[model samples]
Target: MSNMIIEQEPDDELYEHYRFEAGKGQSPLRVDKFLMNLVENATRNKIQQAAAAGNIYVNDVPVKSNYKVKANDVVRVLLSHPPFEYLLEPENIPLNVVYEDDQLLVVNKEPGMVVHPGHGNYSGTLVNALAYHFENLPLNSSERPGLVHRIDKDTSGLLVVAKTEQAMAHLTKQFADKTSEREYIALVWGNVQEDEGTVEGHIGRHIKDRMQMAVFPDGSQGKHAVTHYKVLERFGYVTLVSCKLETGRTHQIRVHMKYIGHTLFNDARYGGDAILKGTTFSKYKQFIENCFKILPRQALHAKTLGFEHPVTREFLRFDTDLPEDMQDCIEKWGIYSKSHTIEEE
Candidate 1:
C-alpha cells in the first residue's frame, strides 16, 4: 500500500489534501472504508459527507463512498476548506461600508488593508474585521466567511461580501462564469499608444519569483486571463487607463500590462518602481521619484465592481473615486507633461 499526502492550497477556494496509489497487489475495498483506515481522525460519516459533496476523486473523477477502490487506482481527497492552521480571530477594525442588506454588503476597501489572514498577516485583515462586525457570516467553500472574491491589499476598491450560504454560492458562480463585472484604474509607466486594447494570456506565478505573476503567452502554463484596457488620460511619460477583467487571476492587470510593455507605475513587484519611461534629466528623475513617494505602491485601484444580486437577481454596480495619493500623483504628472511639452515645442 503506497500512499502520499500532499496538503496544498491551489487557489483561494480549494484545498487538495491527500493522494493514494493503490499497490498492484491491493484488493478491492470500499473507498470510504479505505479512507477511514488511512486518513487519521476521519470518521466514516465524515468521509461519506465528503464523498457526497464530490470532494473524493479516483483518477480525477468524483466517486461515491461505496465505489470500490481498484488496484493501481489513484485516489485523491479535495476539500472546500483547508486544514485549520490558525483560529480566525476577530478584530475590531473599522470598515468603510458602502451598501448592505440582509443577504450581502459592499465595502469600499481602502489601500493597505489585507483582504484575509495568511502567512505573516494573521491579524488586522478584512476577514478579522468582518468577524467582529457580523455574526455568522456564512462560510464559503474555502471556509472563508462572507468573501466571494478578493482584491489585493494595496488596491483600494469595492468588494461585495455574502451574508448567507445561498448568496455565497450564487456570487461565487457569477465570478467563476465571468458574469461579474470588475474594473480597475491603473497608471502605467508609458504613454499607451492605443486608446483601447485587449490583452489575452495566461497568468501564473513567476518561475523564478513566486511572489510575482508572469504572463505565459503560449498558454502552456498559468490560467487564462484577459484584460480590456481603455486609455483615460495621458501624460508625457505615463498613462492612466481603465482595465476591465474578463478573468480574475492573481496580479492579472499588473502582469498583462507589463507584458504589453506598460508596467503599472510604482509597481514594485513588476519592475515599475524604477522610472521605465522618462528623460534622464535631474528634474525629470526627481519628479518621478516624488510620484513614487506619493503612491508608494502600484498605481492600481479596483474602482468599479458589478454583479447580479444573489437573492433578488438585480444587477448591482458600484464605483469609487481614486484615492488621494493617486489623484495627487496624476495631477502632478499632468502639470509636468504640459510644461515639458511646451518646452519641447
Candidate 2:
C-alpha cells in the first residue's frame, strides 16, 4: 500500500508526519533502524528522541525506538510541529474571541482572512493576529501556532486554537481521526433534487491547474474525501445547502459540489460567479449580478464546529449566525423567486 503523507500542507492540521507498513515477508527489525532506511534525512538519534517523547507509534500504540517490528507492522511518526518556515511577526489585528480557557480558545473568524502565512501572503494572516494576541501558542504540525484546524480564507466561522502543547496534540489527534464535527452553510448554483445526500471522491490538485482541486472517482490520485449535504432551501434557480465534512481536504465542499453539478454560489475559483442556473434575460442577469455584489465571495460559511476539549475532555460545540452578506443575498433570492412565481402564474 502507498504511504499517506499530506504534501501540500493545505489548510488543515497535519497529524501523521510519516507512516510505513512493513512488507508481508519482511524480516524483523528495530523500529529506529527501519525508519532510518525509509524516512529521508532521519537519523537514529532523532528517531530515538521522537520515541522517547512518545511520538512514535506502532499500529496506533506508542512504541519505543528499540521495539522490534514484525511482518505487516504499521509504523507512524506523529509530531506536534512541522518544519518551521516563516518567522511569524505578531500583528495587532483584532480578533473576535468567542470563548477562551487556559488550554484553548475559539475565535469566530471573519471572511477574507487567510488562516496562515504562505507564499505571496506572508502577512495579514490569522497566525499573525494570534501571535500578537497570545504569546507562545502551541504550534500544530504545520507550524501554525494555536491552530488545530482551518477553514478557507473566504469561509468565515469558528476555529479552535490550542494554548498549550498538550492541547495541540490532543486536538490534532481528534481531527486526524475524523472525530471532530464541522458544518457549513452553502448556497449553490442549481436546485438540488435530494433533500439529503452524500458526496464521496478523492480530492487532489488539478493536473492542469495547480491552483485548483479536482475529484478523482477512481481513487487513482489524491486523498479520500466525503461531504454530506442537506438541502435547506431551494429558490427556483439556486439552492441553499448545509454540508458536513467527513474528511478535511483543501476545497472539499467546493470541489465535491461541483462534481455533482451544483457548484457553490459565488465561488470564483469553481466557476460559481457566473449565472449558471438563471435565465438569459437581462433583468434576471442583473438580479444575479446584484446578488453577487451583495455576496462578493463564495456563499459558504463554517456555521458550526464540535470537538472534545483537549484538557477537560468535554464536548464543545460552537455555532454562529450567517454573515450579513450571505443573509442579504439569500433574502434577495427569496424575494426574486416569489415574484417570478407570481409572474408565471
Candidate 3:
C-alpha cells in the first residue's frame, strides 16, 4: 500500500539496480524481485505492476512478466511510470458460499470461472472475489493468497479455501500429502467395461508437445497417478461415475479416462470425434459433441471435497449440486434413452 517509485534515466540503469547481483555465472532474476531486493524503499506491489504493464522491459523487448533474468538479459525497469493498478482491487462479483468459518471457506465454483488470475486472465477469478469478500486474506503462495489447490477453469464444483495463514499452510500440506479427499463426478461416453476400477499409471509431459499431458508407458519424471472410480448411474451409452483421487496430478482424471476406453463427453483434448464417430446420430451424443455451444467445457465437476480443518483438526466435508449445463445434458440423455429403447424393441 506504498507509493514509492524508482525511476531512472534511459542511459544509466545497471548493476546497482538491485542489492544482489547475478552471483558468478548465475542468471539475472525477474525485474520485480530484483527491485524488491535492491531497495526495501519501494514496495514489491508497485514494482510488479510496473513490470506487468510494460513499464519494465528486458533487452528493450517488453518481455513476459514471468521472464527470469538470464546472463546479459538487459534489465530496464521504469518504476516512475507505474501502472496505477493496485495489488488487490475488490470487484463486487457474487460468490456461492457453501460453508464459511473463521479458519477457511468452502465455495461452489461455477463452470468457466477461473480459480485464480493467470496470463490472459487477470480479473474475475475466485481469488479476486475472495479478496473482495475478505479484507486481507493470506495465501499459501506469496503471489496467490487464499488458494490451497485449484480446480480447472471449466470444471465446476466444491473448492476449499483457507482464510488464515496457518490454515493455508495446513491445507496445502494435506493436498501435498494426498490426505485431502477430492471427489469428482464425470459423465463419460459408453459404459466402462468394468463397473468399478482404478486407473494406475505414470503420467508425464507429452513427448511431442508442451501444452498437453499424456500417459506414457515408460512415463517421465512425473509422479504416479491413480484415480478410483465407480459407476454412479448409466444413461443409455453414457456412464456417470464418481471419481476419487488417490494421487493428484494435472489433468489426472481427464487423462486417465481417455487412456481407458471411455472419455468424458465433449473432451476436446483427449476425447475427440474419433470416439464420437460411434456415438453420433444419437441426439444426446450429438448434443454433447457440439457441447461447446451448450456447456462451457467437459462434463466434469469436483462435486465433493473433505479435509481436516487446518485450525480445528476436525474432519470437514462439503458437496455441490451439478451445474446448469450438466443438468441440461442429463435431461437430453433421458430423452434420447426413452426413444432409443422404443426403436430397438
Candidate 4:
C-alpha cells in the first residue's frame, strides 16, 4: 500500500500538500498515472496539468507527467484550496483592483465574497470575477486562475493574482519559500495580556467535526504553524492586534488566537460571538450585541501584502484601510469604553 504523509506551514492558500511513499511491490508507471491512483477526486488531466506546472516532485526534484514512479519512490504534490471539481464559469462581479500590469494584479477584496468556488459556494467568487475580467489566465493546481494567495471569504483584504504562467510559478515559489509578507488586523475578545507574542502549534482537521480545525499542542498530529502578533489598541472588553504569519496553515490566526483564550471578536465558529468578557449588565449586553450586529463576521482584515515582482524582480507592497463595518464597530467600542470610564469615575 502507498501510504501518504503530509506536511505544511500555517495559513497557506495551497490547501492539500501530500507526500507518498510507494510500496515496495509497486510497479513502474507514469507519475501522472501513479498520482491518479493515489490522490482522490483527481482526474488525469488535472494531474498532468499539475505536473506541467512543476507542482509534482519525485525525490525532491520536479518531474514531468511522463516520469515513471518506481518501488519505494517518494512523491509530493501541492494543490491549492477548494478542489477543482467543476469547470470555471466567468461572472461579472465588480473587483477593486489596487494594482495591475502585464505580469500580475493586486486586488483589495471586500468582505463576504468567496475567494473561489468550493463546498457551499460555487458562484460569485473572486475567481469567477477574474475569469470574466481576464482571458487565458494561468490556472493553479486548485483551478483558481491567477490566484497566488487568498484570505477567508468573510475577511476583507489584499490578494495577488498572476497574469501569466511564469508569474504564477514565480509567485507560488515565493510563497512556498516564505519570502512573501502578509499581515492582518484583528479585533479579539478581551484585553491581550502581552503587547506581543508568538503562537506555535500543530494544526489539523478536527477529528469529530471535520469542518473545523484543531491545534495539537504536543505535535502528535497536524502541521507546524506559527503566528506572531502585536497589540495595536485596547478596549476594556476587546483588543485590536496585528498578526504576521511565518507559516500559512488554514485558519491559523483564528485558531491560534482562540487557543490563547483571545478569540477574534464576533468569530462565530470559535465562540467569540458570545460575551467572553465584560459586565453582565443589560446595558453592557445590549452594547455587545449591537457591535455584533455592526460586524456579523469575524473582525479580521488582511491589511498588508508584500512580495517581489515575478517579472521585474522589484519588491512591492500594498496596504488597505479597514472596511466600514469593522471601522464602525471599533468606533462604537471606543465610545462605550470612554463612557464606562466616566461612570466609574
Best model number under lDDT: 2
- Model 1 weakest 10-residue run by lDDT: 1-10
Badly placed stretches (over 4 Å) of model 2 are: 1-7, 11-85, 341-345
What is candidate 3's local distance difference test score? 0.70
lDDT of model 2, residue 223: 93
Most TM-score-accurate candidate: 1
Worst 10 residues of 2 by lDDT: 1-10
What TM-score would you give candidate 2 relative to the actual structure?
Answer: 0.76
- lDDT by candidate, in order shown: 0.84, 0.85, 0.70, 0.84
How high is the lDDT of residue 295 in model 1? 91
Report the lDDT of model 3 for residue 181. Answer: 94
- Look at candidate 4 and tell me the lDDT of residue 10: 25
The local lDDT score (0 to 100) that residue 311 gets in candidate 2 is 71
lDDT of 3 by residue, 30-61 (tens): 66676566655778787777667655556545
What candidate 4 gets wrong by more than 4 Å, as runs, is 1-85, 341-345
The per-prediction CA RMSD against the true structure, in angstroms, equals 10.4, 12.3, 11.2, 11.2
* Cand. 3 TM to true fold: 0.70
